[model samples]
Target: MKKVFSQIISLVMAVLVLASTVSWTVDKHLCMGRVMDISFFAHAEDCGMESAIATLDSEDYQNPCCEDESFTIEGQDHLKLTWSDLDLDHQVFLVAFAQSYIDLFVPLEKLPVPNEKYPPPILIRDIHVLDQVFLI
Candidate 1:
């Protein structure tokens, strides 16, 4: 269960990093103050008003009733970090932390058993029979 939980947490963190470093755009088309279409990562389709206005005489050209708007969200562009980028103190701390973390999982030395080489004493008589103690 702990292993599964750690895996899930790692996956979530990876996704979070990916999302922070990714960029996207949102395109919207509005006609007469009402949203006509909304799209992602692509241009929004224009309403029929644009073509109708284009066909009119150039001299009488005026702003079309429809409008197109776009919003671009830029994500982190510099994600490459190197060891040299860290300060000496930070590097030392990181090294110490890593060493300690590794040592945390190191198996402890096996303890010596006190009587591993000793054999059990030989039974000469039935001690349970000699004693009056009996289980009910």
Candidate 2:
């Protein structure tokens, strides 16, 4: 009876820990309440490819793409995407594989941005190579 009771207690404690960690991850890394006004999806659209790459790299909600208007002050730290950021072929690849890249980083429903009721078709068939490069 004591063994059974200890096992049950351990299970409950494990579940509670898992739940709290998930909640904390969603709140902190994903910037849940702080950026509620901005939809992650729309923000992605506005930020585009570089933002996609940044999101994949950080796995957090740090405005992967920022423009002049995106900040209240001028010269605010922001991701300035240039062709130099990625090679020519990679630039084309970014367009080709953007949605897949995003899916790897964030769930569709969790995307902070608003969009069409239906989800878009997945474009990139496989991202094994990209996984090696970006998701290290």
Candidate 3:
């Protein structure tokens, strides 16, 4: 009876520990939220080949044809993308593979100025940005 009781207690403790660990991992691994407003006008980013070579989160979301994938950004600080994420550390840049592209980074003059008239926002299919690793 004593041996069985001890085994049961040990098993319970182990289960609790595992459960807690899993809970923590799930909480920390993904950013969970909802699109609260239609005014949430922002850029949608997709992970390219470079991302695939590095991690799995993108694989979870990106299609096999590498078509348009759903990548969401939470707030302005956290950008959730369809890419490996490099263990959730490398922040990826959304780049579109296109032809006849000359520049990836736009100049300041092209950006909307305080008093200057500007045309509609450009839909750049080919974006180029390097992943930035964060210290967690």
Candidate 4:
């Protein structure tokens, strides 16, 4: 009886550890940059042959704290992302939002990693973040 109870506790502890490990992978798909606003969302599709994906547009949300008139991807700058743009509907917006989500949340060891070959301020995934500021 003692051995059995010990084994059960061990199994339960293993299961909890696995559960917590997985939970750690779930984090925010955050972005920061010149965009007026940024947001993220996701959806999965069954096309039979290929999966369909979508993302939100950054322009749809409120503007950023500020903006620079000139923005370029090559200058090695980071940009915030939002879930919408102008009057465009959700479908169109989702196309980009999906990619952003993957780039923001998924891990390098997991599916859907970022394409770092392209540029700077690259996507950050499975991140732990806190919003704190210090004033001097």
Candidate 5:
């Protein structure tokens, strides 16, 4: 369960990074203060009001009622970072962290076997039987 949870967390983080690095744009066409069309990958369709306004008068042409607006979401352009980009303190901390992480997995030296030099005492009789120790 712990392993699965970690994998899911890692996947979410990867997706978050990918989403933050992606860029997109939203194009919207408004006619008379009302949205006419909205598009993401293509240009928004106009309401054909600009052509009608232009044909009304040749010399005196006012601004058309329809407007095209675009909203751009810019993502990170510099995603590639090198080790040298880190400051001196950060580099030291990273090195120390890596060293400690590696050390955590290192097999510890085997402890000395307990009582390895001691010899077992010889028993001629059963101590519990000789002592008349009985449990009800």
Candidate 6:
């Protein structure tokens, strides 16, 4: 009885370990900034291969972000990037992950005062921010 109980516990533990180690696959097709199709898969090789082979290629998709212009940043220096330079996948990746790069020399504006009722206590205009002033 003791040995049988131990075997049952070991089988249950093995099954739990196997279940925890299973991998899942997610398939998504996006067009025009929208998800057109989505699918879930337990087996990598069996996900879409069988279905795709069974069907004929009949879909033609166009990217909505495609525009005829050189998107450039100007101020500190001239930076130019054209649609031809980056592919659809890379452009999408850049839009999703890359940070917006603003030109450093683009005219910096002072923050607006929150309360207009009171005048600014100190006028910091045209002063070197790093200079230290000593009060006598």
Worst 10 residues of 1 by lDDT: 57-66
**How well is each residue in 76-124 modelled by candidate 1, as lDDT tens digits?**
9999999999999999999999999999998979977899999989999
User: Which candidate, 3 or 6, has the higher TM-score?
Assistant: 6
lDDT of each: 0.91, 0.53, 0.45, 0.46, 0.90, 0.54
TM-score leader: 1
In Å, residue 2's CA in model 3 sits off its true spot by 0.1
Q: Which candidate is the best by lDDT?
A: 1
Ranking by lDDT: 1, 5, 6, 2, 4, 3
The runs of at least 3 residues in candidate 2 whose Cα sits more than 4 Å from the true structure, single-residue gaps closed, are 24-136
Model 2 lDDT, full chain set: 0.53
Candidate 3 residue 76 Cα shift, in angstroms, is 26
> Each prediction's TM-score against the native?
0.64, 0.18, 0.19, 0.19, 0.62, 0.21
| Regions more than 4 Å wrong, model 4 | 24-136
Question: 1-136, model 6: which lDDT tens digit per residue?
Answer: 9999999999999887665555545555543444545555521122343355447565553334322221222222223668789999998877766444445446658867679788767876645555655456
Tens digits of per-residue lDDT for model 4 on 7-119?
Answer: 99999998875655441211122224323332222222222211111233443454333332322222213334455544577766777898888889656675664785776
Local accuracy of candidate 3 as per-residue lDDT tens digits, 3-113: 999999999998875655441211111112332222223433433444664576545464343333233333233445456654433332233233224365545666566
Q: Give the per-residue lDDT of model 5 (tens digit) for 31-100.
A: 8899999999679988888877778857676765788999889989898989999999999999999999
Residue pairs of candidate 6 with colliding backbone atoms: none
Give the lowest summed-lDDT range of ten residues in model 3. 23-32
Off by over 4 Å in 6: 25-136
Enumerate residue pairs that collide in model 5. Answer: none
